[model samples]
Target: MSKSITLDQPDQRNLLDRMAQGTIGKPVNRLEGPDKVSGVATYAAEFSAPGAANGVLVTSTISKGEVALIDEASVMGMPGVLAVISDQRMIARPAQGGAGEAPVQQVKQIDYWGQPVAVVVAETFEQARDAAKRLKITYNADDMSDVVLNPEDADSWEEGPGTETVEQGALPQAMSEAAYSVDATYTTEGHNSAPMEPHAALAEWDGTKLTVHASLQMLNYNIDELADSMGLDAENVHLLSPYVGGGFGSKLGISPDVAAASVAAMQLGRPVRVVLSRQQVFQSVIRRTETTQRVRLAADADGRLQGFGHEAKVTNLPEEEFAEPVTQASAFLYPGQDRVLKVEMGRIHRMTAGSVRAPGEAVGMQALEAAMDELAEESGIGPVELRLRNIPERHPSDDVPYSSRRLAECLKAGAEAFGWDDKDRKPAQRREGEWWIGTGMATAARIHNLSKAEASVTLMEDGTAVVATDMTDIGTGTYTILGQIAGEMLGLEPSDVLVRLGDSDLARGPGSGGSWGAASSGSAVQIACEAIREELCDMLGCEDEDLTLKDGFAIHNNKRQSLPELLNGRSIEKLGKLKPGETEDDFAQASYGAFFTEVAVNAYTGETRIRRMSGAFGIGRVLNEKTAKSQCMGGMVWCIGSALMEDMMFDHRDGHLANCDLAEYHVPVNRDVPHLDVIMVEERDPAASPLQAKGVGELGICGGAGAICNAIYNACGVRLRSFPMTPDKLIDHLPEI
Candidate 1:
């Protein structure tokens, strides 16, 4: 039997106020609805005009080794073939104080599988693709190329933040004194974004200026990188990515497709369009690094953590680098006496891996949350209770007070909603014919990171407002949310507010990543609206404090003046930006969630299926409930994929990705997911930003996989350490009846 207790009364008035103040808590429709649904939204590959030249990218056959020869004559002689460009002469070394600063400009060494060997440009895409196949290239084989780091080889690799040459040999010493320790090694296979539309770019050069329609996350970053690669002035490059199918961090930088298209256009004196093939997409674009994490956790007798250590090694390009930072969130997520978070790197003959969704915490939470579940079981306490008991009121990293922390509230609410109190903690106690029933819980936390963003709001004579920013939507509802904010501030309906984004020429806002787009961009739009309101009051010569703007009309002395009449044919434009304030330094702001799952496991086969899953999110404020809920649901679906089927297999013997296509690498389909119950705990945190909203994008996926894993353990009396808790692994560990 279970008891339900409702501690806090639902405040409908407050909820309505939140919705009325802005679209901060409402479920407004997406602003780009018509564009997306009506097939009017132009993706990179669909922007081709007639007579545009085409370029085909050639990928390296071998994982490693230098290109021995490039015979381009046959490719050049092919019909409609314009030219063949390789690393031989056209690609120059980066110049000093030029655009290609950083690793983007660094060199011609073939460090990983799928590296670009050459590019074939022609009058038609078919001709270019055929020409690419005719190119002759040989490699000087190196046995050291296929080398992968193992536990025994861990010591041989250098330690640093993805750089070579640093003080090594720290893991052994740290693992020694860990009181309650679990020295478990976990591996996550490589995965690519595999967006529906492959990476494509259409570049046209009008002598001095170059314009590129690209598939990129950061338009400005792409513009700068392209300018540097082409040795042109940064001002000469104009990049646009109005719509992106999906990025998942793969589109963070300008990939070879963009660079190849630009170079081909420059050479042929005609516009060039380059679209990478599915196979080339697999090899050339960046993917999530295959990481192996060795984690050592030490906690006191009271289950209070004392020491935490994590070391991760990733397969990355010889020159391209990254630190998995798997131990980053561990420093502050829990209350600990001593914490050491060190990141190390290993060079492998693989594609360069970059940020994917939540870079550090996403993977870190997988190991950390699972370890927390294990520790809770070892302590003879429920997972939810253990987390509640160990909750920290402040951030451990800097001992700063939290502006708002509703994690405990979220846990309590989630437990009540999930019927946690009635759950059978004993493994294999409840059985339903061929299946065993079990329940599990896990918690997630994410820091709120908002950047300086600027937006221009123009109040037109037609009683409408247009908000323009360089922010990319990325399927996260930036377009809708920004329009909602502008609509509220300008006292107009959502339809009356037009939102323009994803062009470098617009008011520059932070590119949508790190879950900062909504908070940062919304705040910028708010500031701009405030400026416009102030300007309207100044023009009316009325006391700014005494005037109230509503329903597209300004009221002064019981007289209503329409915004269009007030503007008097001249558009009212105001630009505003939001910078980090002292509150950011004084207070730690983070979003928290409690994920609960109930699953059924087959007694004999150990097959597991999730019955129901619920997430109680305590993000500061819910901006557009429909979109936020969708984001959470999407993440949950992603978690379902990660928990059961997602993995990129590599042929360890040859250093090639075995499962490179969708047919081999699996994600969760509609059949895998059930209805996900999401509850948003609305709490306002002034520390996060003026919007009082935190990121909910990655938090939903953080601990969801672990929760499912824990549930499976309770159902079948099996403790599986590795991921994708497949049926075979579970059956092997199942106890005899």
Candidate 2:
């Protein structure tokens, strides 16, 4: 028996026609916009249920030491306090071991400042907080520890899964052999996501079942980790994150806040909410790891690349394991003869660092792209021309043909739009008072990633369609995009489609990460909608070639029937799953962009201000122009912050982060940004997927910092290698030019 084949569009109509007639490219407002803007949208911290209590965590003051004692009697006696749980009692049944080589248990000796030592539950948030602060604890400090930030200290650490070790003095040897080379070291400070809503969770125990409302990027993974931590069956635990304000990358996994909240709820036999204070938010949740990058580029006199190498060392917590930030973009950016990229991890006694925004590429580009700009200078070529000369038509690492590449077009368009050809090239030549004006450009790229996702679409008798997937919005406008996909595929208006996401009970989705939210989830929705259309065609006894779906009606042989009439009071349902195919091995899929920046630097005070910025992207088949543009603009702003102000300062005296608050660790505000423009080149690649769409979230940010840093160098003859490129760093060495 051959399987029944279904095809609803055998007549062959242009896909763009169908998309234009539906909601695919329309600028539809977010479905949850009102709820979010009006302050009614519930975050993890705002979740509440009956019999709910409050919880607070106490962190260790010492960076490295063993806890000698924890006297919690005073804290437990406080008013409204329910219980105080210490690490000693919780260690009776340890959590399951990890999947890889890293240890699964919590650190016995405090390896970093702000490590959680105990948690307190009370009837009120104020009580829990007050009690937590009053508890006394002592630590046996160790003086043998030393902070690890210099590359020289990396020798003490061994090579791990995601890190590479390089021998001393080997970098200079590689740089001297090439006809053209740029040897430079760049440093970036640690920065936190600082989401408007801090990490919070509300956990409840109903008999043997556990339910948690937490803010996380991956719902299924959160459930699995939560179950494992509590030693409960996976089915017995449920996780939900309906909405999130913003999660650049901090909320990728289960944080300490979720585990502490669940443990308190289970012990108290009542619902509990744990909301970390702003101060605690900095120390408790994950932050971006600090990095020192040394990049060398070896190119021929004509600027044709010969060899390229990047060596980076990142600070990691002694207790926590993390991947290095360099070598992320080295795998596939440019064509070269010999490319050697190494990433080394140096353990530092600080808060555990994790992903923030684009993670590796965010920092990697700051070094690699800047080196490209320097190489352009040495070769006496324009930055855009230099990039064009080195453009890789295919992946250099794996030797696979690109599914689609338009980076050259992006560079040309962006340069033309930003007036790069007419800008001043020499430092101090176009000075206005104390400011010197200059322009710079860089290129960006990100892999088009897709994962296995399942979605369900139900057609109701009222001609409405409901789509459900476990994907999360995370303030990236996922709901609107998913709705657009479903509406386009099912031939319905945007208003006629409903979207439900961020619940483990729904059909599993790819979850939001690696810029794959829109492409993967939208593809899933498309598959489910196609299944529903096929089912309707079968029930109407119509041949697939003679059918057309428009305005909630199916047309066959010049006869039109409303979806309601075809349903006959029966609802049609379909399930769609996206599975990996041979295309993964056959082709390399990536999204590319070109970033351009114009900056004006003060010659006297060394203060640099971004005058104007623009970016052009070749992200295959933009689903929504407005949202895509917004994503690009947001990334540019983030890169500006990284270049001028964002940095996390560590107190080398105690291995504690000194600038733990936003006031001390600055990000870009409206006053810091200037006029910006974003252009998206619309192209389609059939090999990417049925939708021929790629991820755009991270591409906008990939090379942003590098462009700004290069512009600063152009405006002033002085070369500032360290990030946050502050005025103090450049003031002492201001050039006379």
Candidate 3:
């Protein structure tokens, strides 16, 4: 049997709180941790097929043009060379889909520098690599003359479709009359998702069906994308990603590896395997769009904001519809009646621009919070105090009450825990040896979202339970959380509940993007467990309110009965489905937090080093204390990288990515990070979901980099508007010791 619930109204039952197993929010170890550490888990490429041939993709070297010809005969005679597939279906940019459908087939028209044009298959990996490099390709280059390689070219911009300009009141008048104001422009470079697992796929075709094992996220949507790209029915495509190393939004859609492998398998009538090199992953995957933002804020003498504006410019490929949403949290983060927000997109010859990590707020809030720091300085108020005063009671643009907001609490808690001093306002006054020390703070916010999901829970006759869903873990602890939810509801130890995930044939979940996996999919499991509880009540001939299940036994009227005896050799299975409705939009819902950091700036070298960091978050409910804290810690690490080292460099003339591998690109390593403190201020919002939990995966990175940037300015009195805060940009502007 199946049970469905649409979240149109607040669910006040709070059933997890009443469960007697007492394992819902505890720090349970990951169910699959041993498997992962012991090398027993098999990732996508590890799966073996009977007669698999290796394939290597051939990428374009030009920015934009049509493929004139691919000399297939050039590579066919090579040793062990089997086939060369150049089908148009193998090159669709999977992340640039329109609405709910697959993106248009790219055909032979090259859109970017590293776009995949064809694949070379052979008997072995070395043969395929040799053949792909030697295969000759030609292009007309007619479109290259008009290609726009720079996003800053003013004439190449267009109003992005589906992006809107928000206006509430007269912003110009309010800005001019305010007692204090700030207007500044900031820039951020592009970034890669850089998941641990490079995209890899193995495909087998049986003349009537295709089975592929690929590294991916969101199998529900990926199934449709792969099926559409291969011109096959969705039912005929069996995609399995049972063990994914990591996604980080890089594997959210079907990449060239999956497409090329599927296409090659069908054409050759044999199994095929495709694996992308690390350089290929960096150059071909979707990147986070670089941003240029102009933020204006008007505040009274007391630092109460009266006007706010954030105008941003982002870039994408000509046919790509996804422009990084740079102002997602700006409209409601502060109380400003006279507000305006706009996003302009420029066409450029680059990799497809799409979501990376937190997308909008990860880079957006870095600029927004830095501008707020400027406002605090101009008004002679503390940065924390200024932000505390501008906390809006209602959403500024939507005029709706908040479901649950704890931004103020996070600010206060973080300040107290970090030992922030509002009285020490002067810069360059505190010095330790050759370093100047200072502290800074910034607010964090990520919009709450819910998606439709389905999961199944089955109670067996052996006094155990099983939870099955297509949701992927992606190193975020999905396997443990789902097990906890089922165990909490069924009165069993978390270890006793078996959790099977990352298979397409199971009940489809909402997948792991947008930080909604735990809450959305966990809700379905909770609902299914609730149905099993009702069945037990019926079997025992007792009312629902009188039953208390605990320790693998049922308790009613001060009597206990073993579950095996009550089951009587019968198993119960139930499917639970969740659908979002009016409640999704009825209230302004977001997870709130505050980040604080301390840093030391070297006077001579103009280098910044983090000393300490702390963050306090209010993400509706905490499913696992250990995982939640780990997520916050991970976000803070990303913050350190974004503020100091991470930057994607591109060649100007040809639009090729300059840093095509980790050796050239930079990320925060162990030496760059400091001790991090994470605090979870757990709360519940009935309006958010049936489980009363919100997304926490991306919350840690949203606006966190601002804290590090502001600390740099306070430490050396240098306010640089550019991102990464490279030493070259700071060396010339450093104050004399």
Candidate 4:
């Protein structure tokens, strides 16, 4: 008597609003908060494996060419060096954004600098580190490598394979005849995600079956990837992440350390533990690609767009099939019939290039929105007014209508909250002592995605519900929000519902990236709860529509029945599966927001400090208020880092990362971040999901940096095109003022 609803079309039911339990949108604290704060939560390498040995990885010093020799005998006779493992079986780790599968290489070659070449295992970590330094590795270096570390040296370029060009209504005529236009190039340096926890792994081999604990984001994908890297079948390998401090996409795929640890464990007939040093984490992980974008905008006297052009140049390794999608939103960000766009991916060997945080739009919008600010100045229009004027009614490249868009609403609401109309319009107008004060704003947009997820919910005999899924929390409150969803649908409180996450043995989920984890996993929970409700309705002799579940009791026709009593001293288990439906094709969906920042700049020194920041976000129906705000605040912190001082510095001659540790590479500290506020708007997007919820995890970072970049111009009247508007970049330009 169970029921299921396929969300293949728009849904206006708003079922959660009618639920008797009111926990879905409440500001519930994270269910795992105590465990995390008390340090009882276990992460990778924390588990004490059986007879686990310690391994220290050795990385290559050369950029390219074969390993000329390895003096293995130099370290084997050392105090406790059990094994020095380097073979074709331990292949190059599969990078997430590169080819999904890594094939075994015949030659022991170094693809880039800092690549893992070998691993030394010993009884203790001290012996491993001490003996690893004793071994010597020689390489036949390729000094004539085509490794372009600097963008300026990349002279000749080719068009991106997937670039789209639009030529409608004569672009040359549109630009020539427009009343206002802006054409400029912007460059952004490469950066790292730098999550709190570094990559680590613990592996144990019971005969042929290998069990591993790694700090990875997606476990479902990792099981097969780790097996492939070790030349084992997926059935023989099992990985458990259970709890991840944070990944930010660095731990998406199986890194080399995971492979080396498994190899050492399999050869030595014992478990092996590998924990990356902070410097090694920076040297090995995938980083955000450096980008240079040229934007040309044509607008009428009223500030409405007439033409749009964006050409972006990004860099990646030759073997990688990925590049920074810098112009992702330009096709629909504005409606312009006359347009032209180009994208190029420079082949280079730097730190591995891939997704970090928001990936594409985080750096893309930094250039696009700043160009819009310049366009506004050229047109003598307010920054907010200019964005409101160019709000697209439909996808410009394609003729698709938006499923739901709230960009205009976000801009207006943010303006009202920040007192946009009453602010001084002149740059450096308001000065307090030696500091100049100014404010700026930018519109936020990110393409919302929907992925498939399967979850199982079991209603226990004691009137409790348990949800099982493989989604990792990644410090985003997945435990609390999933519990809330199940609690609202079933007749239970948030505390009464139990949630088990981060196990590959559980039902599959989207696994917490691209901001789609909550929607994908939550939809499965919703459907499973519905099935349970249907079974209960059949037992109560009433229609599911007429049933009301509240506080472990079912009410229909003014009659109440205890859930446990109706269960007949047994538990009922229900499984839910969610797949892509026709609803995604029916409408265009994206999360929209506006970010505003106030800054104070020292006139004498070229230093800038953010005074405060506020954001107005319209990301469908919010699951939990507290968690959503926390995500926004974190995004803004990354914004501050990007605008002030965050970059992966590289040596021009050798292509080696210069500052590979966090001590030299600065992120935001307590004093660096200031007061921040957020306003969450529930738009109730019927086309997004059955739960009517969209993603807000990465949207806040997409446009957060643009506001700070614009604020620098307002305070100092200097527009530094290059990223990380550092004091050196500003001081020279500020001498005229």
Worst 10 residues of 1 by lDDT: 1-10
Instruction: List residue ranges in candidate 1 displaced over 4 A.
Output: 1-22, 87-108, 144-155, 160-183, 297-301, 422-424, 542-545
Q: Write the per-residue lDDT of candidate 1 for residues 103-131, one digit (tens) a residue.
A: 33222456566678678888888988888
Per-prediction TM-score: 0.91, 0.93, 0.98, 0.96
- By summed lDDT, the worst window of 10 consecutive residues in model 4 runs over 98-107
lDDT pick, better of 1 and 3? 3
Query: When superposed on Cα atoms, how far off is each prediction in RMSD?
Result: 6.4, 3.7, 1.5, 2.2
How much is the lDDT of residue 71 in candidate 4? 93
Best by TM-score: 3
Tens digits of per-residue lDDT for model 3 on 307-406? 9999999998776677777898997799789998988898888888877898888999999999999888888899998899999889899888998988
**lDDT digits (tens) for residues 1-737 of candidate 4:** 23345668877888788898999889999888999899899989788976789999887787777898889899999888899988765654553433232322333777667777788999999999888888898888776455555667775666654555555667678889889998899888888879898888898998879988888777767777777677788789887887898888787777766888898899889999988888878887678888899988999989999998888998776666566777777767877888876788877766667778887789888888889888888888989888888988888877788888888888888888877752345676767887878788888888888888888899999899999988788888889888999999996888998999888778877787888888888888888998888788878899888999999998999988888888979887888877768877777788989999999888878898999999999989999999998998888899888888998898888878888889988899999999888888778887888788998888888877889888888887888788888888877776343
In model 1, pairs of residues that clash are none
Alpha carbon RMSD to native, model 2:
3.7
lDDT of residue 289 for candidate 3? 85
List the candidate 4 regions with Cα displacement exceeding 4 Å: 1-7, 92-107, 145-147, 155-169, 422-424, 735-737
| Local distance difference test, candidate 2 | 0.76
lDDT of candidate 2 at residue 723, scale 0 to 100: 84
- Tell me which of candidates 1 and 2 scores higher on lDDT: 2
Query: Which of 2 and 3 is the better model by TM-score?
Result: 3
Residue 466's lDDT in candidate 4? 97
Who is ahead in TM-score, 3 or 4? 3
